[model samples]
Target: MQFIDLKAQYERIESEVRARIEAVLQHGQFIMGPEVGELEERLADFVGVRHCVGMSSGTDALLAAMMALEIGRGDEVITTPFTFIATGEMIALLGARPVFVDIDPVTYNMDPAKLEDAITGRARAIMPVSLYGQCADMDAINAVAERHHLPVIEDAAQSFGASYKGRRSCGLSKIGCTSFFPAKPLGAYGDAGACFTDDDALAKALREIRNHGQDRRYHHPRIGLNARLDTMQAAVLLAKLDIFGDEVDARSRLGRRYTELLTARGAGSTELGGDAVLTPFVHPDNVSVFAQYTLQVPDRDSVAEKLSASGVPSAVHYPVPLNDQPVFHVGLPGEETPVGARVAQRVISLPMHPYLTEETQLKVVDAVAAATGLAGS
Candidate 1:
């Protein structure tokens, strides 16, 4: 089965998608087209935010957010090490230091308890990633940031449709960024992203930053990058947006089903206590979109190989913690993030998408059970 069934999703929205694209083509305003503005309005409303500045990519969105916050050389951004390289890469790109923090053992997200310890005199911002489509503990993270008087940027690339305490993922922080890299929960046809905010000045700054820092035509005011989202991509997103709510619901249902089935076969639990896989744990207050239904298993490589041999595809959201990456590795050997390092070694993601069929899901689960030597419990 496909790891993410994008083709099936395309088929479902084929007509509307084509119509939107056709309209963009007819208008021929490829750069900052009308559809782009329409999408921004739609997205901002969906997230309950006042502004949504469309961007070139999720990485660019993060970079722009930091830029808007004036984070640069000598500044530090605190974030978890158990996520994609883009999080730390953006910090380093701006000549800022990326301070690593450990993740919660259960949620695999930045642990709020570890937040204050990571902050320092140079700490300029807290960038917490919402891993696997579930939001990080934003209320706790925000509280810590408030004490430090620092801004919070939610790297919500995988959690665009998720909710935390009745608030959407991209609307939960001072600056929230999400990706549309064709693989995310709410993906577009090509590279795209957005930054959400309620601050009027920050919103204006973000819009300018995405367009070469031009407040108006040929009026350059600040240093910036060409990070505007393309009109075609915006059109594609607008079409997908129409059905995104249903897709999010389906994904949530599938996630719950995965948990129930894995548990029923006696191969799933909350922790890695035995041979069974340790399933993902969503906080009681959050509604996860389940971008990936990840689990922790012993002998992860062996299990992956077995699953592949059985014609079941699987993937690792991330295998190496950012602190261990050659480019970002600066910590002493003994100072590794205990939980993030350990989880990175064992975490694996199974195929997940809204269109996943129960028959195929059962096959995947059985393959996983056999791989972990827990078949039939």
Candidate 2:
């Protein structure tokens, strides 16, 4: 079984996707094409943001946002250490320091309570990742940013369809970025992403940064990279958007099924806590896109081995905290964020997708029970 069943999704949208691609092919304006503008506008409206600037990839989206914010040498951006390396990589690439913060044990998100203590004169931005498709406490995080005069950049790569307290993930912070990687909730066929914001000037700067800092044709004003999203990717995203909302709902339902089955609460389950696993904690104020439907289990490696043997695929979102990574290991103060470090040793992701069937989930949970010694021998 595939972890993220993109093939299943594609089957449902094949004709529509083909038609969109055909339109782009006829136009032949691959770079800075009309489809890119249309996708950006649609994405902006969906996210309740005033602007959306498309980019070549999720990494470039973050880079463009950092450039627009002028985050560079000697600057520090406070962020969680439990997320994908791209979060810290972008800051390091810009010659800025990523001040690693511990994640909350419950939600596994950046702990807002610890945010203020990490603030220094060099702290320019608060970048909180919406890990595993769930958003962090943006209200509390934003409050700290407001008091300290720092901008909040929501890394919503896994959370495009997620909502926090009636607001969308990308629209919750001062600036937000999301990916169109094939496995994301709302994804394109190829690598793509967009930066979202309400600030007019920041939006303009982001657009320029993604286009070699061009103010007009061939007029380069500042140092930037070629990060424009391709027209084909934009077309795919536009087509995906047609059923994206419905897919989000399906993901949520499927996620609930997994949780129920794993917990021994599904149909015909006689035991409780079937796998002795800890399901993802979604905050009451937020709704996740259920990008991965990950679970924390004891003896993660053994469980994963058994799942693999059973043909039930599983993976880890992060195997090590960012501070512990070799490249970013500067041994600075607050060097090791204990929560993320501890969680990394035990977290394992099960097969998750909007199209995942309940019967398939039952088999996965049964394997989890057997692997974790919860199933009665």
Each prediction's TM-score versus the true structure: 0.98, 0.95
Point to the candidate with the largest TM-score.
1
Where's the lowest-lDDT run of ten residues in candidate 2? 265-274
lDDT of 2 by residue, 196-294 (tens): 999999999998999999989899888788999999999999888999999988887887777766666322222223245677777778888888877
- Worst-scoring 10-residue span by lDDT in model 1: 267-276
* Top lDDT model: 1
TM for candidate 2 is 0.95
RMSD of each: 1.1, 3.1
Give me the displacement of residue 269 in model 1, in angstroms: 3.3
What lDDT would candidate 1 get against the real structure? 0.93
The parts of candidate 1 lying over 4 Å away from their true place are: 272-274, 332-334, 375-377
Q: Between which residue pairs do clashes occur in model 2?
A: none
